[model samples]
Target: MWENLDRPPLDGRALTRALVDGPRGSWSRVDVVARTGSTNADLLAVADTAADRTALIADVQDAGRGRHSRSFTAPARSQVIVSALVKLPGVPPGSVGWLPLLTGVAVVDVLRTVAEVDAVLKWPNDVLVRGDESSGYAGGKVAGILVEVASTHPVVTAVSGVGINVSLTEAELPVPTATSLQLAGAAVIDRGTVVRAFLRAMGSALDEWRESGWDTAPIAELYRSRCDTLGRRVRVTMPGDTELVGVATDIDEHGRVVIVPESGDTSPVAVSAGDVTHLRALDA
Candidate 1:
């Protein structure tokens, strides 16, 4: 149903109207850019001035970025790059840190509903396809999320950016371990449908976050149930010269990965920023 659109760089005005026409609580505003350096970069630059719940969708990004400055590549017509602006109220500065994880939950919900694939969250923020890891297939990194905070007068704006490999083919993937919807047998997907579903899911999540005192338990529970990182051997690389190798015990209340070392000592490490690598035991 959503495939009837002509192509990328779609008319923003028309798309916005169509999305709003569907439901009353959809995105407040939708702006489509033909091309940009990065939707996150563009949105963050004006987040302070933009109205809350505004979204930016881009067809192509010349400098699209992933967590830790990793390059995110997708063919101009095969990916979805979107950034939504959220304003949080009554949430402490420390507690607002879970926005990225919350956003990832919203994304995985939409992916499961539309694609009907068992998608799992990789701790902190990454989506993985279940069962793909054990079958010698690419199991990790189907999508990535980045949330940037901009604080100004009377408000803290979170710019949530998402990169989804929608219609990308196997040959177009940046790495062998990475896959797209098409490669995962979601060939009938329509980009607009995916975007609309994502926005709706995000709106619901944000509303609940604001109402629930930023209590991350509900979202965390959902994340943990769908997360593949828990109880796995992992190596977390920090920004400085610090690294931890342990078994992921649990996701703490603050969205930190709780790790237990091989020495039989339990230490809950709060990872605000880092790369988590899931390791396989030599015998496994």
Candidate 2:
């Protein structure tokens, strides 16, 4: 861990004090570990009995995952990997779908405020920076969010995991389309600061979402405004290999992306789940 001079280890003690003891204390508990297979999976294991706002962060994730069970990993201390358990006793089932979107917005907010990365949302779960043509970066993905339903009987408990690349170099990226704060020229790259800001931002957003009766209108609007996918020609790949090419028009009340098919014969469709690929930008 000391070998990577540029990548400093997170101050777990400071984090626990600020996030758990500070006036703006939003998390009930925060646990930091040196290594974990997956924070989300580990948190889910205790979600049934853990406190409502418990949080878990790992310095290095050996088997981190994203949407659709895609696996990824980063060098030690090169990313902020965290998972939080949020228990919503009365949240509507449909409203639960927006959890991942809410998480994406929180990540973008933290990256912009703390990292100063000029980040934006890529629909359902990705946070990205506008690629620089000169740098040959085709809008790399800097962070990913994954939300899983931990329980639904007694209460709607959700375990949301987020992974933000902090100081990964070009060669360290898991994929060609992936990027890090260092690669994106962020002003700050402290994992602890990023994690703190993200937790606070997430707590605030979740509070608003709950106060709004899981209305989703306000959250949807906020997400749409920051979403780069809304005004673009996109190709969506749904389950079972179904495909739809269209222009993203809006985010509906249920938090689905409304896609207006390029074909004149088909009507607009609101997709709840799929992989969206941005083909080109379009005027909203």
Compare the candidates by lDDT and give the number of the best one. 2
Candidate 2 versus the native: TM-score?
0.95
lDDT per residue (tens digit) for residues 2-46 in model 2: 777787777888998999999988899999998899999999999
lDDT of 1 by residue, 1-284 (tens): 33425344445666687655555556778888878999999988887678788899988888998887887667675787899988886677777778888888888888888877678888888887665555555644678898888773477778999988877777878987787776776634667778877888888888887788778789888878878889998888888957778888888888888877655455666665678888887422
TM-score of each: 0.90, 0.95
Candidate 1, after superposition: displacement of residue 50 in Å?
0.8
Flag regions of model 2 displaced more than 4 Å: 133-138, 281-284
Model 1 steric clash pairs: none
For each of the candidates, the C-alpha root-mean-square deviation to the true structure, in angstroms, is: 3.2, 2.2
